[model samples]
Target: MPFSVPPYRLSQAIRDKCKRLHVFVQAFTLPSCWYPHRIRILAPHPVRNKCGNAVRIKTPKTGSAVPTLADVARHANVSTATVSRCLNSPDQVVGETRKRVLKAVQDLGYAPNFSARALAAKRTKTIGAVIPTMDNSIFARGIQAFQEELGRHGFTLLIASSAYREDLEEEQIRTLAARGADALLLIGYHRNRAVYDMLTARNLPVLVAWAYHADAPQMSIGFDNVTAMAGLARLAIGKGHRRLGFISAPGATNDRARDRVAGVRRAMREAGLRDTDLSLVETQYGIETGEAAFREIMTSATPPTVVLCGNDVLAVGALRAAKEMGLRVPQDVSITGFDDIELAMLAEPPLTTVHVPHREMGRRAAGMLVQILTGQGRPDNVELKTDIRIRQTLGPPPPER
Candidate 1:
């Protein structure tokens, strides 16, 4: 036999320095180079630099090698069966043997092969998430909570962003599904039909978030978009704001935006204000867009006394625009926003917006997914509550108005 060391030999506790060094080189050949300090590599089969003289080249081990169970058993002076028990069911092994075996394995640079374990167990305990965008703090906060909860259940999370694009979101879904994700999480219900079909065909357990509807085709774990936004609009209306300027995201493609716009319209309708009485400006959801939309809304024949933004990002820009235009917030023009993000409170006047329970929703979503994955239970639509955060940002119409 070619002087080849067994895979398990490297994992044995090598008291002999020569044997340890020999096992190190034989175990790892060329691929394992991640932790350079852990192992040394020497030029194997070194030949003489000059004429016919034969010289032996030391083979250096540069990384941790694959250490089998037998290697650990021999190193620890225990039977292979005992080593197996220590790894598979440690409670059956005595304390002294377990400790010695573990220490020996550590000294011999031994690590369990997770891939083989995964194959045997038939489970990866991983969840995947596909969001429209991570640029928004709302998504980021929710995902952080989601991952935290998953960690408690001994599961890992893989996340990807799609930049609010339907096609890219679909692609992420396919990629995650192919990566052996036990469960999947998505931002919203709106997506390509093909993607939905693929998920259904593969029988992947998917949870949709952000906006929830009872009749939605997919499972959801989110608040009712129409109701949440409606509550905010109602709060704005209760403040005696009759003339309104709505700075909303373009509703043509985004169902969430459409629902928010609908909520605003419903509030205006209840107040006996016709559609003509409200000035609506559709723009991208950004600070720059907010500023431009606010300026445009103010240019109306009869400028509205209050401006309601789609979200906090736009509200911040709107507030800046008001100051630039010599208008004091609440006194010159009342401003209201949605999604009470961190920036909402930091604005000149703390934002009067709807506080979304992002963390709670994320936790519940993760918990539900874990339950489903473990065959514990399935979750119904998780409707998280939202509250209207009344702040100094919104007040009665200006005295000038």
Candidate 2:
């Protein structure tokens, strides 16, 4: 009896079998009661069984028709093992044979299965990086440089953003590990102890970037946030701005933010300023948040002479707010920011900020991870320097108010 099934419903195996048998299968609606809708198998010459029902054919299962390493080997007239070596370790194969295999690969559009290759080599040659946020350009340049460096070393980078949430960051780290990341680059040293334990159990090499401490247990390649911010704060104080207002991101889960606040406080204490002199407003990192924080600080009974922002994003926000409030920068109230990102210079009055070597940090971070992974040597914690860029936005307090 004929069976009714759509042409597309037929598996590839059946199609290949029909192609080999020189038969074509088509679906058609039949008026016969025995077969209302049936697939008609047509051959060069019609042949029927005793009951006149089309004979059912069976074909052995086979792999997908997509080109494989074996197909490339066959086309290049080389052994499968030789094809594998040519694709993976090209230097292992002779120049002439390598050229031939590569040609076959291109002609057949053959793509090696990376999953299978990774399984065989016991390495993925892939690195995963988890950052605090991707909403801003703060980490953009650094990550781009890191990726370029990784590419130069014949590795790939996979990035995930945690939106500054510790729990989500932990989840992404575990997911990356489960996905067989050969290594990982984390933003900071602060995380659940279980995260470190899991990495140790997996024997994964982990590198911490963005913030650094000499006594940290994990390998770190970054600047000291406290020292960098302290240097900037001291510069503002030296300019004769006694009253300082700081707008910072929440420091509860952010070591960088916490250190920056500490740095400001240290600078104020050294400058003989009272605790009441500095007014701090903690908020998320964004232009609008910075603007709102600045407005809040300015409305206080005794607002600061200068507003020190956690990063350029917040600083830019403060600048925008100052403009709308008819406040002249450095005249009405001075403002400063960290992370001399491009926005700092582009501000109405170029921002006076701390210039972090973002690209160098990223490139060096990648090199450090590669070194540890390849067993070249374990690197020491690197403390890069941050310089203060004095622009138009920061100066002496406005003529004693």
TM-score of each: 0.75, 0.79
What C-alpha lDDT does candidate 1 achieve relative to the native structure?
Answer: 0.80
The 0-to-1 C-alpha lDDT of every candidate, in the order given, reads 0.80, 0.86
The model with the greatest lDDT is: 2
**Candidate 1 lDDT, tens digit per residue, 1-401?**
12256333543343244344644554465433343322322223222323535433344564766777888888999998887677655677899998998898788888767577668877667899988677789988899999988886767899998877777878889999988888899877777788888988988999998888888877788887788877777777787777888899877657888888888889888888888878999988789999999999997789998898888999999999999999998888889888889999999988888889898889989999988888887778877888889899888776652
Candidate 2's residue-wise lDDT over 251-347, tens digit each?
9999999999999999989999888898999999999999999999999999899999999999999999999999999899999999988899899
All candidates: CA RMSD (Å): 9.9, 8.9
- Give model 2's TM-score versus the native structure: 0.79
Show where candidate 1 strays beyond 4 Å.
1-64, 67-114
